[model samples]
Every structure is written in structure tokens, then in C-alpha cells.
Target: MPATCQVRVLGGFGVTVDGSPVPAHAWRSRRAADVVKLLAIETGHRLHREQVMELLWPDLPVEAAGANLRKAVHYARRALGGPGAIAVDGQVLALWPDGCLDCDLERFNRDADTALASGDARACAAAAARYGGDLLPDDRYEWWAEEPRARARSRYVALLRAAGDWTRLLELDETDEEAHRAMMRRHLAAGRRREALRQFERLREALRERVGVGPDAETVALYETALAEGAEPPSVEQTVAVTLANGLVAWGRRNVEEAERLAKRARALALDAGLGHELGEASTLLALVAYARGTWHEQFRQEFADSVRRSANLENAVFDAHLCFQEFYLYGPEGHEGAESFGRDLLGIATAADSTAGRALAHLLLGEFALLSGHLDEARAHLDLSLTDAERAGCLSAQSIALERAAETQVRRGDRRAAAALLDRAMPLAHSSGIRSHLVIRIHGLRVLAAGGLVEALGAVRDGERLLAEATHVCDPCSMAFRIEAARACVRANDLGRARRHLAEAERISGLWQGGPWSAALWEIRAELRRATGQTTQAAALFLEAAELYSTLHRPLEEDRCRGAAGVR
Candidate 1:
């Protein structure tokens, strides 16, 4: 029988065999102990011999490292008690092969994954409590441990924030300004002005001691208001901000009419107040309403052009960046004249303004610009930058958008597995941005479907269609994209009935807007649909038509792909 192994690495590192601590003197060498430690921290407590040698003895020659790994494995087995304690099959090594291991990091990950997937507050609190501290604090300098340590620490902090455990968070990191601000806001929101003031002072002390800087402008503004004491009438900026925020909430909840009303009100208030920043925000909100209603090109320019120009002249980087994103997002960039230059100009503005959010969205625009121009590598680089900037900016919607675009690039490059992983991470963030609506969620469902087993594709098809039926937006372009992908997926699954229906809806939507990617997409999918139905000559013609449209869009990769399919036909 295999011995039960208990490994703890959250706060520190230790191992127990059958509930008894392994005596320190029992270990033959420090490297032997380190070998056990490394394996215990890795996924499923397993690593191939080559990888283990690379991580543990990268400087040594291959033969010498392999010899050392053998000795280490032998010592590790003796230290843990019994050959079954550590298993080696050929070149693969794993700790506790009998599934008798009790690992704190594993427990914490399970709890954290559950909490994140469910979005339950109580679950988050439980996961936060389960985190004993940083992972393997004693091994902080180990290169191999750094990634897992940082990942665990990040998850713990996110859980703490979600659970509203600010006090505990402050105990963990004294200079956490965001945590302090959250405490201050809670106190002020509850009419406890004195408490809010005290919180701000605590934050100021922490900042001065740790970073040697004063509070930032936003915090300072809040502090001044705290000094005056809570519960005053909402000011002009406050009113506009509130209105726009509520509009966002309404949009997320699919109450488009209410969102439109709030957007209009916010715009009117900002215009009357003559606040450039608020006016910029207000104009974007109106633009968002127009987008939700699928009249962006027709309604947006006429209704919001002067306000947008005014905001840009006022140097509102966020406003300028968002307006650029809207155009690129709707039209797919390169097909529209001057779109690439517009994105470059916005990127320059965002950089000069030092606005992380502006930079994030600007990069997203350029990434899409690159993507539509068939520059998959360039698109991926831009999207990666966007994701990093978005995370630093602490904006969920921006992060989600960046992740989705990155996933799209992966799918285009025929890496559906990578696409699936990204979409999984993007789902929760997209929820708060109203993009988790069926309209957007189902758009990439086919990629995820492709990631599943080919034999199981039909099951995924049903699931994807269920999501498709829940569409909650009037955006024709979005619907067209979703249906085309759905049609493609269905054709692969040999479900031509569903394929034809999806293609029909997609065709109807494409007819609304003249020749573009949608038309190209429909032609490509219809070719496949025709092929599935044994119409070989007609399918060849449709594929050629699709290739021509793809060429017009400068999508050389896609054009070549369609042309190849035509050749095959």
C-alpha cells in the first residue's frame, strides 16, 4: 500500500509521511529535498525527467543532470518512505502516484476555482481563508517556483478583494491603496464621515512610509470630500458619472431602452455643465447606446459628432480612444479608409496622456486593424500588449475585450485549444461589460466547439445553438458573425439542416450591409454547406466568390484558404 503524503507549501514548505513529519536528518542531501519540493508543487505532482533536470540543474551538462536527477529521485523516495511514495515510469516522475496526497495548494486552487466560476461571495471568502499565505515563501528566489507563487498570490488577493476582506488584505499588504480606498468608500457611503477620514489618513501614512508619495488626485478629491463630511447633494460631474454608470449597469442587464434614456440624460447634463471630461464620458455612453441598437453608423455621427470633436480638442484621451475602438470594432478596420492611421494617431494620444485605459483600448483597435489586414502575428502582439495594459488599468471590460481579440487571433491561426483557454478566462469579465450577453458569448462558441473531441462535436453544436437562441441585442453585424460561425460548426458536425438555417439568417443580415466580410463569410460557409449536400460544382463557385471578397478585405490568409477549398472542390 502507498503511504499517505501531506505536503504544505502555501505559508512555507514541509512534508509529512502517514501524518508524521519526515525527520530533517533523514534527507540524504539538500538537492534531494528540493527535488521532492519541486515535484509536490507542480501540477498533479508530475514532471518529465528532462524538464525536472532543466529546472533543477539547467547549468549542468545533460548526462550529468540526468545522473543527479537519478540520485535525487532515489534519495527523495527514501526520504518520503517506500518506493510507491514517488513513482517513476521511464522518464516521467511524479510524487504520490496512489492519489493519497493531501496538498494545501491543491485545496486552495480547488476552492478558488469554484469561487471564481460561481461568482459567489461566500465561496470567495472560503477560498480567501483557505489561502494560508504566499506559496513557498522560503523558496521565493527559485525561478521555477516564481510563476506558481505569483499565480497563487494573485488568486488570493483577487479572492480577498471579492470577499470584501479589506482589513485582512491590508494586513497582508500595508500599502494596498485600492483596499484602503474601498474601506474609505464603504465608510463614506454609510454616512460615517469620521471613519472615512480615518481610513484616508491610514492610507496616506501607508503610502508615505512605503512609496514616499502623497495620495493621487482621485484619492485626494475623496479625502477633501471626507473632510467636509458625507451626504451632500450630487454635483454636476457626480450626476453625469452616476447616470453613465447606471446606464452601463442597465446595458449589462440587457435593458437597452433604459440605458438609452440614461445615456441621453447624462449627455444633456454634461453638455449643460460644460465639463469636458464628463462630456466625453457622456458622448461615449450615447455611442454605446447607438451600438447596442445597431445604428452606430447612421445615428452616432449625426447625434454625437460635435460632442466627440469637442472632447478630442479638449485632450480627453479616453474619449478619443473609445470613439476609435467603436469604428474599428464595427467595420473591421482596414476595409474602411484611413482606419489604420486613425488607430496610430489614437495610440500616440493615449501614450502622451499616460492613460492606461486609453492605451489598452487603442491597442485593441490596432490589433483588430492588424487582424483584418491578415497580419495574425502583429495582431497577437498588439492584443498581448492590450491585455497587459488592461490588467494594469484594473478595468474588467478592457481586459475581457483584449482576451477575446487574442483568442480570435489564436482561432484564426488554427489553435482552437488556446482560443478555448482564453475564452474561459474572458467569460466572467465580459458579463459585467454586457458582452457576456448571448449576442457576444455565442460568437466564439464555434471555436470552443472545435476544441472539443470531434466525435463529440454534435453535442457541442446543440449547446452552442441554445446559447444562440438567447441573443439579446439588435446588432446585425454581431448576429451575422455568430450565425456564420454556427453554420460552419454545424457543417463540420454533418448537421446540414441547422447549417442552412444559420446561413439563411446570416445571409439576411449580410444583405442589410453591402459587400464585406459578412458576405465573404456567408459565401464560404454556403460553399461548405453546398459541399455537405453533394453540390460539388455549386460549392466550387461559392468558394471562389468567397475568395474574391476575402481578397478585397486584404485577408490574404483567408483568401488563400478559400481558394484552396475551391481547388479541392
Candidate 2:
């Protein structure tokens, strides 16, 4: 009995006969495999000899290439164990129909196209899986293989995406920006905002690194929509919580005016509804705005405390969790032990409730606390977990914040390359969500720290200063940090006038926040400026003050650095 001919071309080019492998040496001529692949993939498994000859040996004369084609055909037939396997007419070559020629590429195309046309997602998914890799991956650079391979891969990706098999599509083509965008949209639709935002970042990096281009306008617009306030209030009574959450989202994106307006509206709605939880949430948001606007430290502190008490008394778990998270932001660095306790409580509540956003925020608080305490490895682990939770929950705002903190951790670990890579991945998502100001300023400050030259560092400081001046909430903690960093950068550049101005501004902001983390940074920069200007005694005093603040914050590494700077043990 004649052998059955089987061809596999999806992952690689291969031929078998009667369920037996064709020995590698049997088709020693490179063109033999090429001939078999071409014949199998061609319409009706047939192609004109001249066409095959042209594709396989365009460098040779027509007659010489024809001779080579004949030799290749003979080898192919022998490899298939019979001349009848590949029959040649006067001008055409074909896999003999009677030979029971079966090809995976042909079957994949037929099933995928049919399933797509029928809108059968399950069938399409099954067909798409058959495409294990690019068509004839080994022949990737061959001109003859390009068109069909691309067509197969594109169809496979489209089918997988349509079937909601994002993982498989990504596995097939990691550099496919469209696939990434589709998956991002899917994640967002499923309420996984952090995952969506992370996908956008991955797409941005892949496009930039692989193709030297950014995402198209469509992708950016979609991300912007994802970042926008999307809650729909089902009734007037429910408007307060929806509006409050929207206000929080706006604030996260640094839209101060919009946040304030939404927060005020939410408060009004809460009062009308007589909902204690709504009122508490609204109050918390308003307090955050006040703190960000550089309100007096005592006033902000009292307001936050009042909000927390009200939220706790409401006996609302969600509202209480929100209040606890806010408290951590307000005093977490200065009171690490308290922050840890609150974080653990929030984590427990969120886990029990299966609230992805709450868990993400809890992890972020813990991560930031760990990072501040100089526990680098622990901080990294916490940040990673925070990012994971945020992604799974589809919280873009939390994802962006976690990514920034992760980059900061990398910077502290003295990995400029890793830090830059992280920032590069983060900036696009931040921009998409309209939260780029603070992150951009931080990036500029990081550049100052990492720059090799005084000139470069000074330039970065100027950029950071410009961003701070343009920010909607210039008194935010990050803005204050930017000012201190700018002052230090200017001091290093010997630009005394700008350094003094930035230092004075930082001091003014620090005065509003009192003994917060920014105060330590402000004093450290002041000490540096004083030391540079020959004010040794004042510098020593400022350094000691900074050291004490760091000690209070439980940042022993920073405290020791300050003590050393002050000429103490």
C-alpha cells in the first residue's frame, strides 16, 4: 500500500509518510522541504512548476532553477516513500489526491475562516489553538513565506481575540499592540482597571522598544476613557457614593477643580439622603483635597481626625476602610506601627469582602510604609503584591501609584537602569489617566539624582520645578518633595539664587505640614544649602533636625545619614 502524506507547516515545515517520520538526511536538499511546503499550502495542493522554481531559486537562470526544482521534487517524492505522493503534470506540480495528502496549514485556515465567518467563538478558539506558532517559523526571512505566514498569524490572532482568548493571542504575538489593546479593553469591561492599565503600559513599552513608535490615538483615547469617572447612579439616593467615588478618581488623576466640585456635590447629596457612610466618604475626600492644597497642618489633621471618627461611628465597613486608608496616607510614615496595624485590618476586611480595590489600597499603604523604612526587599515584595492586586481589580490609579513607588524602590536599591525602565513603563499610563504631573516631576527629580553631570542634573531640576508650578495641587506631598529635590539640585549646580528660592518655598510648605515626612526632606536640603554657603553651625543644626525627623519616621538609614552629615556618631 502507498504511504499517506502528511505536512505540518504551522510551527515549522515538516513531512511524514504513513505515520513514519521522514529522516532528516532524506531531504538534504533545502529546496526539497520548500517544495513540499509550497505544494501543501497552495490551492488544491497544486502550483505551477515555473512558479515554484521562481520562488525557490530566483537567483539562478530559469533553466538552472528548473533543473534544481526537478531534483527537489524527486527528493520530496522519495521522502514521502512514493513518486505518486507528488505528481507533476506538464507544467504543474501537486500533492496527489489519491495519496491522501493531509496538511495542518490548510486545515487551520479552513476551520479558522469558517468559524470566524460563522461567529462561533468556541470553534474559532479551537481552530486558533492549532496555530502553535508562526507559519514556517524557520522560513521567517524568506520572501515566499512572508505573505501566507502573516495572513495565518493575523487570522489566528483575530480569532483568538474574538474568542476572548487573550492569553493565547499574547503568547502567539507578544508584540501585537492591537492584541494588547483588545485585552486591556476586556480587562476594563470586567472591572479590572489595574490590569487594563498595566496592559496599556506593556503595550507602550513593546511598541517603543520593538518598533520605535507609540500607541495610536485610538488606544490612548480608550485608556483615557478607562481613567474617567464611569459610575452611573441608579437613583438619587445612590448618587452620593457614585459621585464620591468619581470625585476620588478625579483627584487621583490630579484634576483638583473637578474633584472639589464632585466632592461638594456628593456631600450635598449625602446630606439630603441622610446617609452617614456617604457623608463620611465625602468628608474623607474633602480632607484629602485640603491636605493636597497645602492647608495648615493642624487644620488638615483635625479635619481628617473628625472624618475618621465619623466614619468609624457609622459602622460601615467600606467607609471605615476608606477612612483607615486615608489615615495611613496622612500619618503612615511618621507612625509606622499604627500604619501597619491599620493596613492589616484593611487587608483582613478587604480579603473577607473580596474587594479588589480595597485590598490593592491596603497593599499600597503597606508597600509605601515598608519603602520608607528602608526595608528594600520587603518594600519591593509589597509593591509587587500591590500592583498585582490593583491589576486584578482594574484600578488604574492604584496601579500608577504602585508603579511609581516600585520605581522609587529600584532607585534606592541603586539600580538606575531598572528605575528608568519602570518609569518608562509608567509614564504612558500616567499620561493616559491625566495623572502625569506628579509622576513627571518625580521622574525629573530622579533624573537629577541619576544624572552624570551637574549641568544635566540642573536641567532636570528645572523641569521638575516647571511641572510643580504647573500642577493643579502644588502643595501635594510629591510637589513638596520636588521642591526640596530642586533645591538640592540647584545647590549642586551652584545656582544659589534659585536654590534659595526653592528652599524657601519648600520651607513654607513644610511649615503647613509640620513634622510630616516632607519636613525631614526640607531640613535635609536646607542643611545641604547651608553647608554649601559656609554656614557650618546652621547646617549642623538643620542636619540634626532632619535626623530627628527621620528617626521619628522610623527611617533609620536616612537618620544615620543625617547624623553623619551633622558630625555626630
Candidate 3:
């Protein structure tokens, strides 16, 4: 019988066989033990022969590396008690992952993912506890180890955030400003006014001690708020801010009526206060509420412009520019042409301000523009920049959004495998700490891939669909868009009944934009179903109608495709 192997690679590297530690002298060489380590980190305890050789002995000649690889495997096998423990399959090396192996890396990943997907505090705590430390601290300099180590650290931090284990986070990274800020927020929220101040002091001391810098502007703002301590009446700006904050929270909950009511009140208060800045923010909020309601008033664009004009007197113009861009992007049907200008404006302001977070947003918008305009190369460049900036700034939200856009670009470029891999990378990030909208986008991509015939994505679609069902109130148009994709996917799978159901659901909410892109999509998909069901004439007519709609929307590629589709038998 084979001796069971227990592998531990989080924080440190160690192995035991049959409940006893494998001594250093057991392996023929360190390189041999590394062969096992390499395989242990992988998803299925496997790596291609070339991959193993390149990683382990990148400086050596291939022939030499191959010989050394064989030698390492031979020695590692003997140390681990041979055949049942490891083997080479054709061009790949694999560790036996049956009853013979128990890997902490796998267990930690599984538990962490479970917690992330659920967002349950208890689950987060459990997962955080399971994370002994960073993955393979000894191999910190290794390129392959770096990614897994960073991923593990990110997930651990996310878990700590969810569990409110600030001490643990600080223990792992004393210079983590986010952890410190989160602690401050917790203190403030709990009415621990003095503690909040003390927390801020701790952050100030830590930053100065560790990096010789002061707290950021945002952190200082929080500190000032804590310092106020009801010493004076709330200013008009503060009062307006509270109202707008409530309205925004209402909007997030999909309570459109309540949000609209609160927005109106906020606008009144701002007007009474005679503050142009707050007025601009209030107007922007109202426009957002209207957009969420899927019924933009006639002056929507004017409202956004007026808001920006109102905010121009302020030193920080990024806020108003972002508000305008955000609202215009929502009205995709009529305001599509204007989105680029606002995006450019945002990018310019962000660039001038030297704001990494702003540049990340700007690049994200530009990337979307390029992707939608059918410029794959431009899209990739913009999205790549967005990811780089987002990562550099430590903005996980921006990172997740950029990944989503990049994955979509990959899908459009006909690289389903790359799209799937990108989404795989995004899933954990989104699940851990991302907003509901972010998760929806990630899930939407997964389901789209599944519909595009990526079989592996099929397994993940159910969870995605479940989350979508709960998030219908987030963005009505988004709901219809996802359903359109799902319907098309179902049709591709030849599941006509399911497709029709999805189409009906989408069309139910599409009454607001009867001739928009989504309406055009419904026409094209209906044509597909008709053609699938042997109604050729009906299908062609629908195709022509969709082509006409696409032409009206300035979608030349989609128009051309639909036109060609109309003539396809």
C-alpha cells in the first residue's frame, strides 16, 4: 500500500508521509523536493514537462533541463515512497492526488472561495483561520510562486475584512492603510468617537514610522469628521451630503420611488443652501435615479451638463465629471454618441490631477468605447492600462471591472479559452469584496461564455443565474441585456422553449426602449428562433428589421451582420 502524503505550502513548505515528517535527507536533492512543490501548487497536482523544466531550470539548456527533470522526479519519487506518489504522463508531470495526498493549498483555496461566494461572516472567519500564511514564503522570489502568493494574500485580506479581523490584517501587514481605515470606520459607526480618533492617530503614527508620509486626503477627511464630534451645527454642505447619501443608498436598493423623492428633497436643500457644488451633485443624483427607473426625462443631457457647469467653480472637478459620465453611460440608447466626449473629459481631468483611480476609470471607459466600436487592439491597450493602473493604486474594484472588460474583449476576439481564464481570475476577486454589480458583470460574462459553447463555464452558470435573479433591481436594462444573451445561448444549445422564456422576460422590461440596441437584439434573436423553427420568410424579415434598427443606432458592424444575415437563405 502507498504511504499517504500530506503537503503544506502555505506560510512554509513541509511534507509528511504516513503521518511522519519527511526529513531533508530523504530527498536526493533540494531540486527533487521542488518537483513535488511545483506539482503541489497546481490545480490538479499537474504541470506539463516543459512548464516544469522551464520554471525549475530556466537557465539550463533544454536537453540538460530534461535530464535534470527526470533525475529530480526519480529522486522525489524515491523520497515519497515511489510510483503511487508521482508520475509523468506523456508530456506532463503529475502528483497522485487520490487518497494518497492531502494538500493545504487546495483546502485553503476551497474554503476561501466558499466564504467569498457566500459573504457570510462566519464563513469568512473560518476561511481566514484556514489561511496559515502566505503561500510558500521561502519561494517568495520565484516568479511562479509570486502570483499564488499574492492571490492568497489578497483573499486572506478580503476574508479578514469580511470577518472584521483587523488585528490579524495588521499583524500580517502593519503598513496596510486600508485595514487602518476600516478600523476607523468601524469605530465611528459604533459611536466610539474617541476610539475613532485614537485609531486615526495610530494610522498616522504607523504611516510616519513605516513610510514617512501622512495620511491621505480621504483619511484626513474622516479624521476631521471624527474631530467635529457634534461641536457645531452641521453645515449646509454636510446636511446636503447626508440627504444625497441617503438617496444614493435608496437607489442602490432599487427603491426608485424613494430615491427620487429623496433626490428632490436634496435638490431643494442644496438650492436653499445656495451651494452650486452640492446642487450639481444633487442634480446628478436625480439623473441617476431617472436612469435607474429606465425613463430619462427630456432634459437628462442638459441636467448633466448643468451639473458639470455648476461644479466647475470647485477645485476638485473630477467628481462632477465622473457624475456626468456615469449618468450619460446609463442612457445607452439616446446618449451613446455623447459618452465618448464625457469619457475623454474624465480622462483629461484624471490625467491632469495625477489620480491613478481616476485614470483607471478613464481607461475603463475608453476600453469599453474601443471594444464597442469593434477596435479590439485599442480595446486591449486601454483595458490593459486600466488593469495596470488599478493594480498599482490597489483598487480591487477597478481591477475587477477592468478584468471584466478585458474578458469581454477576449470573447469578442474569438479566444474563448482566454476569456474563460480571465473570468476564472476575476471570480475570486469579485466574490471576495466586489459590489453586486461587479459580481453580476462577472457572472454575465460566465453565462455568455457558456452560451458561446465554453463547456467549463456551464458549471458556473447556475450560480451566476441565481445571483442575477437576486440582482434584477440593480439595473433594469442590465437584466434585459443578460437575458438576451442567455436566450441566444439557449437557442445555440437548441433549447427553443427556454430561449423563448428568456426573451419574454427581457421584452417585458424593454418597453421603455422599444427601438434601442436591446430591442434590436431581440429582433435578431427572434429571427434566429424563427429560422431554427423552419419559418424562413419570417426570420429574414426580422433580420432586415434588426438591420434597420442597428443602422439607426450607428452600429455599422451589427447592421452589416444583420444585413448579411437577412440574405442567408
**TM-score of every prediction relative to native:** 0.48, 0.46, 0.48
How well does candidate 3 score on lDDT at residue 85?
Answer: 78
- How displaced is residue 62 in candidate 1, in Å? 69
- Model 3 reaches what TM-score against the true structure? 0.48
Q: What does candidate 3's lDDT look like per residue over 1-569, in tens digits?
A: 36588999997999988888888898969889889988998988999999988887765679999999989988888888766577667887789755568899999988988898998988899888888877887765355776778887898899988988888888776667788888889888999977987786666545433343345656667766876786676666656655665665576677888877877887777655566555655665676666566655433434433333333232122233233335236335652565567667767766766767667767877877777666889988999998888777655655766787788778766787787677777766655532344245444644475344534334344444556543322344545656777777767666665577678877886786645677788899999999887898999999999988877767666788888889942
All-Cα superposition RMSD per candidate: 15.7, 19.7, 14.9
Q: Kindly report which residue stretches of model 1 are placed more than 4 angstroms away from their true locations once superposed.
A: 1-265, 268-281, 284-337, 446-460, 471-476
Alpha carbon RMSD to native, model 1 = 15.7
Residue 295's lDDT in candidate 2: 56
Against the true structure, candidate 3 has what lDDT? 0.69
Which lDDT values do the candidates have, in the order given?
0.70, 0.69, 0.69
Estimate candidate 2's alpha-carbon lDDT, on a 0 to 1 scale: 0.69
TM-score of 1: 0.48
Candidate 1 at 4: error in angstroms?
Answer: 62
Q: Please name the candidate that would achieve the greatest lDDT relative to the true structure.
A: 1
Candidate 3, residue 512: the lDDT equals 60
